[model samples]
Target: MTGLLVKNYGIKKAAKLSGVSEYTLRAWERRYSIIIPFRSESNRRLYSEYDINKLKLLRKLTERGIQISNLSSLSINDLKGLLNRVDSEIISTDEKYLQLYDIASVDKTINDSLEAIKNFNEKKLLLILHRAYKKSNFLEFVENVLFPVMVKIGYQWKSGLLRIAHEHFTSAVIVKFVLKISSEFEIKNKAPKIVITSPDGQHHDFGAIIGDSLAASEGWKSTYLGVSLSAEDIATAVNQTNSHCIFLSIIYPNDNPRMEAQLLELSKSIHDDVVIIAGGNAVTGYKDILTNINAHIVKTPKHFRDTLKSIRNQIRIDKRENYEKKYL
Candidate 1:
């Protein structure tokens, strides 16, 4: 489908619209020919509306782990087609790969957990996860087995291969583990206190627990205020905790028409000093709204950690500068 016809946009506007840096855009054009921009007489680069949409789609697909090098030559329709297919590398239902793959021993851990879920044995599932945690580092378990297992479980549920009870059981066990681990390793004096929770209508809360765990691991005092909270309640919790950042976790079927309104209200109610972020499966649907309201969207635990660290570093810099100005 053709995007809207608009005036030719310069490189800066194109990068902002496409969510690609100007340097990256130039690099992609030179190396991959992803979206070649038109050049003016003075050598300024210009992009059309169609080019902008294509670049945005490329960014989204690349974020999902598709290599831009492989996708650069394809049309937008081809990219969409590939995305529509089940990502075989990720949430594939292929029995051969699911039951037999032995890379890093992570596949076995994931398959074992899935089997325990199938048998409706919560204890067994938790045992497998605990064993995996014992065998691998926290980040390894999170990135390799835990996160992939959740994605596979969701895919199975939506495909009618599993029931809601299975998802609930797994979520309950995982959240318990996340909280226990976070508590075990928390630094009492950690700065940039972070508050995580699901806003009203979002029944899933595992994402919040995961955020709390990661934030704690990064030496942040992370507090999880359970799920299904109204805007006023969330704001109250943040205010009470004197949180430096608030993370809103959203789950699938995020058909909450009131979500944007709720976010806007919460943003307005909270102190401007606090940073707001949204994450989880349903975050894509609210990206535009989040950006409009000055809220950040993080897609992975690593991304979340990096964002917090950047903020913490900036705070440190500001404090050092203030101290120097006062005394040195």
Candidate 2:
């Protein structure tokens, strides 16, 4: 082997130097071919210094909201150029300039996404979402772009400005985009698992799709049981996956007594240790029941994000305690 190929860095060292977890490094390799380390005679992977540096760069960019999918094909020089732009933006202390730059990019994204939806152009809609995803973090993308656009579409559809076909088209496009992005995220096998679904009769599933996508972004292994699932079926899935948490999306048709009973059944069926989170427009109608059952009721998208953070933190604490019990 040439001197340059003297792979001195093992996976742990590479991960340490790159400011990423060993699992994330492996995932990047598998998903994006970001770096394919050499195999030793013993069949163990070994990364060279160059591979370590490249991974470091990728980690920095991805943390700043750039998608790994977009960076996989770029050369080192191209990567550096992008990094330089991010650095420039950070170093500038001029509040006015920063504000304008931020506003322009965000406004453009929202406007373009709305126009694409109005035109019922699925291709353009997906492209716009991709661009937004690249520029903003998942939370920002959902809040500024997805939420606003969906609200506008709903309003127009209800006000007789847009036909039913338009609402259905928009829903399909959004669901497709969310599912595609969720599938792209890689979660460690040992990461906390989550189950996302809407109960039977709650046919509106956009909230459920987005909820699962958000969980996946936080490195949670999410078992997404699509809409219209029975209480027994959801409980079965939770048991099957050994999920740490469950998120239920409750939309219209809020006054159903049967739905209330289903929620109660789910709360009773799942293990007490599992966290239950319920959210959506119709959730308010069952607040008393959810409270009695010790289920979390997220009133808004932002609240849902915050609740997931708490859940992830709890998962970390549980893992640490288990690790101590086993080894320390």
Candidate 3:
């Protein structure tokens, strides 16, 4: 490698250093031409120290409600000055700015996605999803963008604003999108494994998709078994993967008589140490059963993340205790 190339970082390293996803970094370089990276002899993207620093500054600015499009041309000193102003409260109050921007931006994208679905414009729908992915951070993209879009699509389909075909189209796109992005995330060494899916008779896979993706973002090695697997299959998969947790997404058929039995069977089948977490619109209908099995019922997106953190902490505690007993 040339000395100049040796001094730069590769795309993955740059992403790690700057707290950005690989796709979004590529988007900024390609779409905005904000920081064109050097191409290695092997055609790899190599970001110089200057480029990584600029990306960090741009991320902070975007977090504080300054748009990314306006940031590309600013000098390093200018970016630092803006950050200083933000720290000194010269910019709008952080929470207020974030709250307003997050709401408006997420709402607009959701609306646009629905519109594209309504028109059966697959291209436009995909464009919206990609743009949203590029603009939002991991949580905002999955929780605020994808989850709400799924909810709205479901609601609109039931209310006859959109047809079943439109729903299928959206789900197909989301499945592909989720599958692609899931591979892009970097997992931690010896990370906990999680199996994300829904019980038999439940075909709504969006919840599991979201859960699986977010688990990867949380540094979990997630295996997303596509929806509608029976309790026995899910249990076997969990054991086979040696997972630390099971995330069940229950989205419809609130009155499925078999669901209670399935949940009971699942609890009995999984390893005793495995954590069970249940979520989705139909989760409440099985609350009694979930509670009986000691499953964590996460009601909202934030609750889902918080529950993951809690379970991970418990896992750490248990590991420490086991190590102390064995070695200390």
Candidate 4:
């Protein structure tokens, strides 16, 4: 069988098409031995169309639960066999998955929440959260119910079904609940000083608040510097708080070159010892920017927790070294 020949695409174009950074693409090639493209006469990598298509297929399959390591060893024929197995598994479990679909199909509950928010019905919103909090694991309920409902509210706000004021009201209520939960957890050690802020022109901050709350709950002393903070303001907060880490919640992509430039500048201005971490929707398509800024992009709640744990260990080591230098 003849392998499909590919036309080489430049790194930038390939990154845009694959929704993966050129750095990440290069890393995958070097680390995983996947998609080895030929070099051009100018010493640029020329990825074939065939290679691009395969990458797209690979991304899709992996997202659907096909382990990349397993797929990496498979020949084209073997991949087809594996895909068939995946399809069969998906079909076999279709009934179990249908519960999610069914929940999504129920528009009335979502609509009611939107209406209640639009009408400023705080009682209804509080009742909803209160009931969910009591009936389910607080964190699970937040992840499953409140998060989905918030997404719906956002959609409605975007579509003009709900107003910005209404959304703010809903958000304020949720923030209170998150803080309530945070209050329950005790700080173990001198909380590692951390500062949380939103990037400039990005005002959605529920995620930041939640992150700060979780960090605090896990024994990190975090200063929540609400929304619309410029890069300079963030630096100021970092200095004022004597923070070791700065976490920014970005909720949308800033296609503006100025914003990108600010992020780069911000990265350079911060102390080398400080870890800059970014999370939320705004940072989704801009992971490369984070890399450029010497920052880490965290994609999920689990990642956030793990990062805090790692930072805590580093702090412990630093404290021990400082004590030894002073006494021994």
Candidate 5:
């Protein structure tokens, strides 16, 4: 009666329950001789509930790079003992697996936004849009798909398929999302600082917030001054913070000339060691304006990553040289 409680599950059902592919399950059973299942009278492999639970644990361990050969020698009791010992240390690994499921479910909400935007359904659209924007790595989701969806929603609103209230609601949701994400990452050290901010008249600060988050994630000491700071204020912030880099975001192309002039003035006011990095749609048509200034121009998030890596490397090299001179 106790054994009967462990109902036999077929391979497909085991795969579904354990979140491992059927091919991988077969490989584990055949190649590694792990989790040998019972055979039915018809000679088909059938896994009991106990065996399925064991397989789930095995899959979790294997994903974390525990050698399969080592696992093959362990009995069910032995595996359970190992899991009991290591489970606390491996919580983050387990969380990653759970996050995969959460990410897939959140992505469905994004897909719903696409459909709602296509149908011009403001109510459904706003709900789904808010859900997707709250997901972890939402900035990537926004840059890749949600941005285009927003453009479509805007076009629909202009053509009268959607109301102005719908557009305002969506923008407010996005602003909150940006704020939430930026606040999640904090400056933890006193490394050479980078101050990122929006230029004068530039109310849009999402790009700057995203850049700050990226910097924080990469362990950069960055001060985000948020939106609507004048060029003089930004230069003063840099001087006061002793920041090595000033990243100015220009979200609209029409503001490039003014932004360029402001940045030029700021660069002149700052010390020669400080670097100015200009980016976003505002620099789209005015690449030439950046030529006279000592600045690095980054156009996208990927470019920003590469540029940040270079800056960090240079900082390291400079520090190493200084250390050699002082200690050696």
Candidate 6:
């Protein structure tokens, strides 16, 4: 299909539209010849509507772990085919991955939890969550059970499939349970400290709670600061706690006018060494502010875990350096 054939865009516009960086786009054009866009009279590359679509598809596939080299030779139709196989898309992991979480059982648990939420059956919901918690490790439970269930509940509430009360009820239960479970772990003396919270105007705290649990799992002494704290208060808390890092979870209100101001305030208040790790659905809205703060934007749980590991290594290295300098 000839898409927007009359209209063409410059590389920057194409990058913004396609969600691919300009450098990557240039490299793909030069090295891989992924798309030979129209060259203007001044030799500036201009991407057509078709080129933008191709770039967007490429971005989506690459995000899902497909290599650009493998995809370079394929036609746009092939890319769509790879993406459209929703029921049979191939996963990159080994058989052990499949065995890690029994999909059938996890789905059943998710459904059971949803039913309990619908019925407002507190006892049954807690029992189900407890069983899932006992059966799986922290990451597995969060990814396979907790996240999926909460996401569906969110959608249902948004669609008016369920009452606001049900959503609040589920949130209350999960928050308490997660805090209780996370508190069971004894923070080691050497564990890095981190404060997990959502910024002011962001009401959702589930992401912060999960982040707290995950940080604890990664040997970080994470204090769950809850949701909707002003930037100044967060800065004070971080300073008081002497936290090694701050994790901000932005889940809802993707377009708050004050988001940029809040992020800017937080960045100004915190120490430069205090790393800010941001994640969740709404982070994209304040991308420019986050960039200015030098925040690390983690896209997945695995990425978050890897970032934590790197920070921990850096902390140890610093400590060792201090010891050697004192004695040597």
Give candidate 3 misplaced runs (Cα > 4 Å): 1-106
TM-score of 2: 0.65
TM-score, per-candidate, Cα-based? 0.67, 0.65, 0.66, 0.62, 0.56, 0.67
Task: Please write out the lDDT profile of model 1 over residues 171-239, one tens digit for every residue.
Answer: 888888777777788586747788889988998778888888888888888778888899999999899
lDDT of 2 by residue, 271-320 (tens): 75677888877887777777556576775566677777866765676577
Give candidate 1's root-mean-square deviation (CA, Å): 8.5
Which segments of model 1 are wrong by more than 4 Å? 1-106, 325-328
Model 4 clash pairs are: 6-48, 6-49, 7-48, 7-49, 8-46, 8-47, 251-282, 252-282
Best by TM-score: 6
Residues 1-328 of candidate 5: C-alpha lDDT, one tens digit per residue: 3783365788877765554545567767888888777778888778787877677667656544477778988877888888777656643322432443345444566457646645556667656655665564644654544444555555668888788766666665555555665566655766668999977877776568767766766677888898868889999999999887888777665544476677677866776666677776565455555644535666556557667776676667657766877999
Summing lDDT over every window of 10 consecutive residues in candidate 4, give the lowest-scoring window.
91-100
Distance from true location, Cα of 116 in model 2, Å: 2.6
Judge candidate 2 at residue 148 and give its lDDT.
Answer: 67
Off by over 4 Å in 2: 1-108, 320-328
Clashing residue pairs in candidate 5 (N, C-alpha, C atoms within 3 angstroms): none
Question: Please, what's the RMSD in Å of model 6?
Answer: 10.4
Instruction: State in Å the error of residue 37, model 6.
Output: 37
Q: Relative to the true structure, how large is the alpha-carbon lDDT of every model?
A: 0.76, 0.78, 0.78, 0.69, 0.66, 0.79
Range of the 10 consecutive residues with the lowest summed lDDT in candidate 1: 92-101
Answer with 5 or 6, whichever has the higher lDDT: 6
